[model samples]
Target: MALFATMSMTAGVSPATAGPEQWKIMPLGDSITHGDGSSTQSSYRADLWRILYPTHPGLDFVGSQQSGQLPDTDHEGHGGWMIDDLRAKTIGWIVAFQPRTILLHIGTNDMDRGPEPEQAPQRLGALLDDIEKAVPGTQVFVATLVPSKKAAVQERIDRFNAAVPGVVAGRAHVSLVRMDGLDPDLDLRDDLHPNDRGYGKMASLWGAALGG
Candidate 1:
């Protein structure tokens, strides 16, 4: 599926800085953000930071991630955190950070757990609602969950991606970023996590989405 409409950054804000007015971009997700299966500096999130730092020149990007954390950022995304775990763990952290923009990549683990195939949308919707409540003015970039080469996992990812747009519907501050067709080669030795090249592509796509 295609991406959703473009959403504006939060208003009345200058570029981020080290001070109070600084815009903080938080990468909230599971192992992807943690750079699993790759070296720490080579992880996509780190690569993204390298790309974004000089480009933005004002924004202060911070990462709050734990390897195998659930709900991705809030709890633990690894080991298949369903929507329920997301609601419980991630909401508070987003609120506490009060970031201007949030880069959210989640729901992959949920597919692994084998929840009712049809329930992905509802769960994602609920997660969106919780995020809105927790951070009223935060600009949310909802990434289309990346595809795994594994047939069963990829099928579930497809269904989850389809459901993401509906969850963020009518939210002017939310946008769906399509990462589906960007990397077809897989480039992953594990057939799950991305290798350095794949991570570079992922970071590049996100940089494009952010207009970096």
Candidate 2:
């Protein structure tokens, strides 16, 4: 599950098919994924929807709340949420949305302000485990955390990202999507979330990840 290996293998796995409810896709994570730092309060999920669904016209974003662009206002991103919190709720979410795909970009808030940042990856693994167990055929795109400028914070982020590949190892339909290279000082609206241009870059990165 190394990034290079995952990148190579992820290709040619065509996107999930649209069904009666469209191919439900859930963007799952914390405030950064929730678009907290953005002026419009819509994260990359909004931009990602704009870029992919317009041409594909097959997938539908789904979640418990709506907070993004029109026609794309669905995701499971909760501000200030932690990995353990997400793990606890993922099963119920899968039951509710029945998503074929999950775009996961979490761990930032945990790294920044966790009681134990070092344990974030293990928690992430558990979350993915829950998802795979609950939804056997679902695909998961696991993103490396975007950088935090502070050295101490960024170091933890790196460690969490390093452990991500192993977290997904031998797991069905789970792949790592690179995000650490998306620099936080430049891309972030403040200390955490992506700005408008950053969101666009994120959407483009997701496109590259999905080969869209």
Candidate 3:
């Protein structure tokens, strides 16, 4: 059967009970994570909630900042924020919520306006380092960026994506989610943001990672 079908089968085994106050899952990133282009403004978090909630009834999305239409709307996504910007906030957020899992997709904003876009991976590494220091046991999922329409930006994204595995190599609590398969012409609502369908695809990947 299909993956989601399997998820459905598994999900029915439990009743929804756990909430954001109990499970503390942080969705950390920029505009995409904030659901900027989606019609419902639900983002992947909504769909990811659909996929994981039934099985993880106690799962809670936690962050200081909240957006999207999800029941657990808490998240750390900021519009136009870059890796370094997030790095500055990560330690404090982790300390506050003490999340059980962290979904991280950042760095695209760095390509838009930064002194050195090429340094994104290094900056991502630093963010991960901060995350590790804050909460050693929390599971962290880092995603490669979805495709951008602009060729110049895509080039920087490609280089940054290529270096992600290296940044995640030694970290046992972290895993890489390759989000580069999105078709910019079809998946993007604008130059940088994913449309609803694209966000759904992202949610599927995240669900698969977490389910594993």
Candidate 4:
């Protein structure tokens, strides 16, 4: 993986020299990031922006996501995507955008389509490697997969979350944001997606992780 020392920004500005008013944040992940089962601009991404921007006043949270898509910024996040698909499409966009920070919410797709539970760690590690290679010094915040009400899928999600910390352990720049108890009720409309209240909770969790 490639590594670059933190590049200096002008007066707290980012590499793109995006002004305080223009600072951009790219949300990269599966449907959760795409705000599945919700209207555009009403998803968690927007909620997170609203929660954080007031205090920061320099960041612009931009959505490069789509429903039922993978990692490609222009495409929608498909309901189920594996680690390979994530690495293949998302890495390129992260490199291109070079956002100050990346808010990631993946692995649900991996859990849904399984038989390769053991490979989750390796795949997640490679995805991290690709992110570090593409944009050295970028802060990669790995969010633990949210809980699903479905017994089988929820169990798989639990296992995936359990595996993530170890995969990212000892990496100075990577931090894990635990979402375990954010909503114990699993308040999702379906076993797969969250409702408005759930999205609010998710946004709050992200805000706390980001120091909002």
lDDT comparing candidate 1 with the true structure: 0.67
Instruction: Please state the error at residue 121 of candidate 1 in Å.
Output: 1.7
Q: Which candidate is the best by TM-score?
A: 3
Please list the residue runs of candidate 2 whose C-alpha ends up more than 4 Å from where it truly belongs after superposition.
Answer: 1-21
**What local distance difference test score does each model get?**
0.67, 0.82, 0.87, 0.70
lDDT of 1 at 148: 84
lDDT of 4 at 4: 26
Backbone clashes counted, model 2:
0
Per-residue lDDT over 19-125 for candidate 3, one digit per residue giving the tens place of the 0 to 100 score: 34456689999989989999987789999999988877778889877777877988888999999999888899899988989999998889777769988888898
Off by over 4 Å in 3: 1-22
By TM-score, how accurate is candidate 2? 0.86
Report lDDT (Cα) of residue 156, candidate 3: 86
For each candidate in turn, give its C-alpha RMSD to the true structure in angstroms: 9.8, 10.0, 8.6, 7.1
* Candidate whose lDDT is highest: 3
User: Where does candidate 1 stray beyond 4 Å?
Assistant: 1-21, 66-80
Better of 1 and 4 by TM-score: 4
Residue pairs that clash (backbone atoms under 3 angstroms), model 4: 20-58, 23-60, 66-76, 66-77, 68-77, 68-78, 69-76, 69-77, 69-78
The TM-scores, one per candidate, come to 0.77, 0.86, 0.88, 0.79
Worst 10 residues of 1 by lDDT: 1-10
